[model samples]
Target chain A: MTRPPPRILLVEDTPTQAEVAKALLRDMGLEIRHAETAGRALADALANPPDAILLDLELPDFGGFELMQKLRAEGVEAAIIVVTANASVNTAVEAMRQGAMDFIVKPYAKARLTVTLNNALEKRALTQELKTVKAQLSRDRFFGFIGASAAMQAVYRTIEGVAASRASVFITGESGTGKELAAEAVHKASPRAAKPFVALNCGAIPRDLLESEVFGHVKGAFTGATDNRVGAAKQADGGTLFLDEIGEMPLEMQVKLLRFVQTGSFQPVGASRPEKVDVRFVCATNRDPLAEVEAGRFREDLYYRLYVVPVELPPLRERGTDSVLIARALLATLSREEGKHFRGFSPEAERAIMAYAWPGNVRQLQNVVRNVVVLHDAEVVEPAMLPPMLLRAAIRPTAPHLTPMAAPVVAPVVAAAPVVAAPAMAEPAVAEPVPVQALPVPLPEPIFVPVPPSPPALALPPLPPPLPSVPVIEPLAVMEKRLILAALAETSQDVARAAALLEINPSTVYRKLQAWKTAGEIP
Target chain B: MHALRLQPLGLCHRLGVWVEPKVDRLASRWHHCHVTVLDPSIAGQLAEDLPRADFLLIINTFRDDLARLTQELTAAAATGDHHSFHRAAHSLAGAAAAVGALRLEASARLGMADEASTAPPPPGLSARIATEAQAALAALAALAQGPG
Candidate 1:
């Protein structure tokens, strides 16, 4: 629907002046209302406010400035333009100080009046638009999450839909993608909110102690079991038990966990009888649980039993602008904690924050903001205040090159074909020559250049020695294959021990070996 | 009061002229203006700035204010009251300035010079203002009756 024309209230005591102003306004296709006294103008304005007001300073009842004050006090937000015969600078200043948008000396030209009115109207429109955007931002904030992106909105909706249900919820996301927070939100939104919310990270505990941690052990059950302790299952009797890194739970533990889940009962260590308790299970994993099941590391029955409701959280990279919002919030909080005066990030800093893909998600953003707050003492966070690695990731065009046996890196490789065909340890292909000098820190050029890969010879040195002359760069894929074979030979072909020595996931090692075997690259 | 109010219209009728409604309509349609008439020396500036309809509106308002202030000035002059005469003359000056009546404005300003005096306005000052008012009304009526 089309909006009505702007209404203008003209407050002039003189009949001739009022008639002239009305004619000009009507000619401009505006709705005009005339009042001969300040009292009438105030009453009309308070009753039905117009878009703009043309006020004469000398009124029969009171001064126009006082009327302006009254209008402000009463919250009538019409744009007031002081139209007075007095052209004194003092009068103009006083009128503006009283909140008049503009001062027009009587008998103003048509062009001047038109331009001023249009400017006031445009300012009002911009203010209204800003108010609408703020309102949307506030609405987008749900539970503890601050994001308005479509992906996060869908996650919020899914959580709200499944919160009251009794079905188990399995959340899947990259590390630091707020899975535990999502589980807590589900518990808070459910009828079990008043009960305890127990959380245990399956991967963080030792395999021997994992079973006892889930279901309490009796006193003197074994070494380090001197006291009878209640476990997460009993602690979360009526509430949610959040098991983080469920994919990392050992196969033996998975059998007991599946039995407990099927019966809602568990046999504690050294306890003869079984103890029963009600629990709503919520599990999360950064790894792919289905892939773990296919590899026979996860029980397929337990996976089906717990994967009833799936909540896949979008990574911080996919959540546009949310990184900025989270950074600002973290800055405010971290500054308060550190007794700093930082209010927000500079535009360049915000741009960098938005451009970089946060592989570690909100956790990484929190650490980056905390690092700035603790190190810098300023009111605004500049790009120089950010961590060097974040700055490089943000400014660098392509993703960081990942070694085949190295742990997974979440950077987006723009040149997908080249990344696949090129050697694994090759330097990332520069789409264009970036001006590294523009960066605050002058980094060495060798950091961007390719270094020689470790040799594939079985007699591998502990570390590659610095070359006396320019060393020849080797293919990264060949070096990676040799390193794996060397590690396997040293560990007597034990993939798990080799993976441990390499500090990468055993599943990663297994997958690589299977790929090599299928291609007949290795026997 | 009635005779004073009818004076300008009667003068227009006696001159064998009447303001044409088409001229008022045409002027209203043609001109949408806002003018400042502060300088008394800018004679006929109001005529050039305003359409005939707007000029007539100001003229009518000036005529009414002139009749009321004229009565007040006559009473103050007869009663030897300088304060009332000064007040009436100040308002009459403003009214004259609204329509750019230079001669009437000058006469009213002269009457305002007795603001601090205990005695009444100067002799013949009221007559001077009355004469200027009559001449101004006649001129405004003639302007209104001109061709569109």
Candidate 2:
């Protein structure tokens, strides 16, 4: 269960808008995949459905509505977040009707993205948890987790042990260790399970807005603060607050956070009165907090405050043949997704999965399985079909001690009946992972039906570019001209009324018009 | 989240788009903007464009616009389009002054004079203007680099 961040598909045409979004969400703990056109976006989504999609309506190949419709039909379940310059209600209503999670306009602040993405990530986490819980086999698993190895067994024990307590739980693991999943497990096992579970990755948001994100901001708090919205801290009141990558938080904000943690009160940015919230804190980070403290990057007092009950997650390489187990699980799920029957992996492929150091953990395994399901039609996945890294890996024997625990789960899954594909269905319960060598039953036939090629493009008017530069005033002069002309025409050439509407002197307007005429700029 | 930003040398802390505020006395009388590097209004507008806009980007944009307008002014003078020359030169003058380049501003204003009062500008004017703009840009680069 190497915890991969939530995967997000970003469909945007303009580089600046994409760049802006990346900067804002870089610290939010989501893995973002950018697609400049609808074709690429569809390809990516079809290959591996993301947890969320930040879609730009105006695309080169198709409209967002068409893409969303296609994705829904194909069982791609990622939440669609509509991002456009025009935040019109009609667009909002249409996008929502087409299944958008939320709508946002351009020139958005760092705080704005934080709120939107946090909600999307939460929905995804909850959905995954729900699916995992509903599946009969998953009943034995903790949340949406599956691992019977000593490492995962220890994690389950820790989450169960701490479930009833109100103590701050700090979970630490390398990049793919399922830290967020573990956090969700903690929330579900706790008394606050019925309440909300709000989480934020301290590393993924802009520093200026991080305070506003955690503590919330008032209207006009900063340049782009157009409305007042509650932050995660307040939103998670009477619930649990999980702060991932707590190590990445700025030191100054750490001081403020320490204060809030000590006394359950905080003031939103630009707010006069402080707020009090009753919430439990569950924080996590990959780096050694003690090292961070020595480096002077992390606050020592804050570390001690948050590191009460630390849960260390194991990396994939150390998890023995769990890669094979996870890969089979992924194959079962993704094969059904692609409607391809990849009954199982070849002996060499199994050996490679067992031997390769899966630096990307379960997420990478999922992708590799996806790669095979997408490109090849064979029932058995050969090592050559695996990623080059897996093929080039030194084939090490599976650790003997870890082999026995996975033996019992392999037979049940293969012997069991094939599961049908349903869009809103819960995840099939994760069986005890069956080691590759322990697999006893013969798998079903390889179905060679490849996915039909995409249909003709659904053309929609492309959105205008975000950065529109004018040769003269660039974008500004045009706006100024429009304002002036609108005022002039509205007043029927009454300079006084037009100037009053514009809050400018009539003489100034007259002078500008005369200058424009002199320069032959206006008729 | 506030702790995660990669700030540059204790300067304009932003989304890795680090830009330090002015270090020299450019906003004073000795320098046209000895109190600030660029006109406060324009600087504010730039910041508005990117509330957390990096100072490095502003410097880069200013440098690019200065070089481009210098070329435009030269081309207008070459074609004997005095009005175009005046427009380009005036535009350059305003932009240069806004960014605190006194020498470049003065040079650009030379092209702003009416054609009726003076002969068309000579070819070397462009070269001189270019040189001044280059020097001004170099100064800004130094300001960005700081003592280090």
Candidate 3:
């Protein structure tokens, strides 16, 4: 559990000064490595990073300032203290500007060297501690995802746990639930963070071009392919390739994708040899992938390969209070973007936001907040500032509680009507029970016959059993029409936005509207 | 003498001596005179502050650098290479100040200022620098050998 002594890299061309620095640093219980030139110092520091560096300005190869710049550019996090014979104020200033923690003149006292080095080491430790704290704080707002709800916390935990592994992560969520953000979070948390993170939406690309889009293409591969191109898979070498809407990927492409996923190699369009890349795969889809597999839309083998690790993002309604949290955050950001001065939402607005089911999830919330910001300028967002659809949904009542009288009486009446035998029915009785099935039948005329009091010995068979009633069912086309109309209404007749909320193409919605208009179904 | 010989620059670049026959004869003759080698206050402070082992190592390194830099300065002066002479002088001054050799540092600084002149260096400037360097090396040797 004990930490190793801090190591220092002493970069001084002057051997005498270097030895002096080594002795002083060693006396403080630190490990020392000496480099007589800037080139050697750079190579050593990069090969084995030290805890701190004591740099002399007048290196034989290059100036100390240039060396500092190169070290920082290469992501050397060690603290640097510039030790130079020149005691000019400008030199000290320049060194500090180049990220040197401290500047010391040559022939320094042992006490001064000790204090400066200790201070630099202590500062470096504090900086590292701060970075760790920041990373922990990022859980509440991970790479573009903002929520502290239990459902979101679980999602964060899943991403963090699976990021280090090379297994393909399959993220499932309702549309607008930040699937791409989760994929990016995984990439950022992984060891490949410094590499590329390439994302391709499988559903957005045309089926004919999806293969070439994913695996790159050579010149003249297709009719209009004028030049060679690098695709997402190649671009994400040593990093992550995120395939969004994977369920929408054509079945034919899935087979090719399966081969690529299994072998880490793929032949570009019109290419003889296959190119290989080291890439981690993270795929996402809003559809029920299992259902897609059952229906034969998605390849079962590909599904198993890519679905090694699953992360399901809860819908906005399931993430309690997160809607309001996200709304407030969006309001602040949207206000800033629109150059508005809105402080926050009114309590009534917050309640409305919480009550309404965000069917479109965060994306819808963002749109609503942006809509309010662009149209209205106010100190606080009142309930009236909310979208009309959201307001209507928020005020809608729940299903009514049923009383005994209001309950269905058809079953009991139908059962009891048969118990009253035909003989009893023949008596002159005005209060005889009538079968419920007779309600829907058309009668020639209204006729009521009186029954005799004396019962006949020969009892007529019980009236033929009433015809069975069939449950009414709406046609699928009608249902689809109703849903499309409702979505359009909710989005205020914005076809594109409605299509997005419904997870359909805007072109499809436009075509449907045109057909309806031509048939006089819609005006 | 043993400490000076242990410098990392090798035996050819020994203090108060040179490999080139011309500088070697001139350096041997200049070593006879007595002069202020180093400032007592500065050198003494350095000696009292450093560990005995570290101080000895520093003295040896300083000896090696002095001989090498003096040779370079003399060669630059002989060829009238003003740029090289100025560079050597600047480096020499920094080395001198580091070890508390104030007079040699001042002399080197004068050499640097003279670099702006259109004429060759003032006569005997290299000899003056050599004498001062030899004196400073002798004093540093004595200090290293003194009671720790």
Candidate 4:
């Protein structure tokens, strides 16, 4: 049987642009579903769950950023290609930073769109693959290391290959990607596995004290040298020396380090002759040493020396589903540690976890899992149990609840003389709908109802003081507000753009008008 | 009326892996000791020859190129030609492994091996390979910067 082309949800507000985009994508044989409002988009996405989503940055109801956040929160993993007109480097960077798969500026040809979609699809595949690897990694542990991804497996292989050898190994990865785990794994696998696996952060210590910390100091060597102390290099002479963030070390210290690795000899601060020692160097960093060398921050000689055999740890995001896999494992570990009877995440919670773009990687995931276990009471943690920030993110398109503004048909009786009149220019319905009944102040004598008059009315009464002149009254704010309310009512107030069009600056609008609703002036 | 309702407060616990401090400093010093054994001129020789002191570069490179390489391979396979694809795939396979993109490297190797089995390559293979391979190579090249 011949299968139809993949159906794609195109969420755009403008009719003309939507038609054009639909046609462009349709020509490539993709079936398109158009959603003009955020509410409609959310409903359609949830209902059908298209294979891919083509989103507009600017929506009538919500900004694209928040919409993406919402989709992610809902665990919608469909390939999303942001179709945006507001294309700037900052916006692109921000979008990519926000986990957008691919970005294309406005006025792009169908070819460009197709290319971007293809690239996005490929990335999506890799992301899925990584997730699978993570699942595997979560179950296995070699030494103190824990991971299942192919990257981790490779690290495991390298650890096995190098642990028995006396030759040095350099471990590398971004901050928090478990480079230390790799080092420890190697140390545990080595002949000196029984000895202490001493670790160091090169960037943390001051330049002056670094040498003393590594090579030891005699009791009378310096002002702070009150007692004879063995340095890290001396202390770990028979074991493994795990250097972390090694790129941050100063050039002066690099020379002394070179002497130790070359001859396995070092001198105390007060002693003259060199002291013989035996140790293996395992360096790690988030910084690129080669770039540092090219930039003259790191010595090319030092870099070549450490390059002998290298082990690289993949970042959390790249490790794919391993993030969630690891999170689940961590949850179990944490639950046991806290002595809590916490079950895993609820379905909604799981979706939220998978969708979050973890910039801090594993460390961030671990922290979140730990928090969930300790803070919440329920055995199975629901989405609501998550942090407010995350819940806010999950909502995505928070269309502000629009209240029909109750206008005074007449000006206030006790108020000062009427203000100066402005021109009777036609105003667009650009201002958001503020529920009149919710206003803190009393409504005017005559209220402009959202519903249209029985007969087609020609003119509308002038807006009262403080309420700007709105040209059209019938079927404007009231109609949209009613539509949004109906949708929200249907969706149980999830506010995934279906219930209301969340304004960008919602708090301000709600704050100014909140008193009216409470005063019972207008409902 | 906007009700300022505060719900039942729930507690959250956060845990982080504690890293032993200053071990990297000693390690870097010792690391420097090992480098002094090698000839200074050999340090900058091959991009692949450099120390894996910082794997972030490799990760970044894979991030930047993995998609491009995939696209190229798919396009080559679709077009039924793959000389450039073979070359691109081989290089990328090595580069991907170096940075820990096992899936990508595996895919590239598969594609490269497939290309070699054919006596005469298909059409449009070179352009597809060139485009994708160039992108992936450029990204991986940029990763050789420093300790990161």
* lDDT by residue (tens digit), candidate 1, A347-447: 76886687667777899889889889988999998876775445444434332331122112211111121222223554533333334323333232221
**How many pairs of residues collide in model 2?**
26
Query: In model 3, where do residues sit more than 4 Å from their true spots?
Result: A1-139, A392-523, B1-148
For candidate 4, the C-alpha RMSD (Å) to the true structure equals 33.4
Residues A1-523, candidate 3, lDDT per residue (tens digit)? Answer: 4878998999987665676667666668888999988999999999999989999887767989999999999999999999887678999999999999999987677778899999999999899899985666445677788887878888988998899999999999989999999999999999999999999999999999999999999999999999998888899999999999999999999999999999999999988899999999999999999999999999999999999999999988787678888988888888898899998988767766776677788998888999999999998998777765454333332101110121111221111222221222322222322221122221111112223343422211111122112212345456457667876876678787566444466888898889999999999
Candidate 4 C-alpha lDDT tens digits along A85-120: 555789888887777777876534556777777677
Clashes of each: 0, 26, 2, 60
Score candidate 4 by TM-score against the native: 0.41
Arrange candidates by lDDT, descending: 3, 1, 2, 4
What TM value does model 3 have?
0.44
Q: Output the number of the lDDT-best candidate.
A: 3
Docking quality tier of candidate 2? Answer: incorrect
Tens-digit per-residue lDDT, A208-258, candidate 2: 889999999999999999999799999999889999999889889999999
For all the predictions, what are the DockQ values? 0.11, 0.01, 0.23, 0.01
Interface RMSD values for the candidates, listed in order? 3.8, 9.3, 2.2, 19.6
User: Candidate 1, which segments miss by more than 4 Å at Cα?
Assistant: A1-138, A393-523, B1-148
In model 4, where do residues sit more than 4 Å from their true spots? A1-139, A388-523, B1-148
Q: Chain A TM-scores, one per candidate? A: 0.53, 0.50, 0.54, 0.52
Best by TM-score: 3
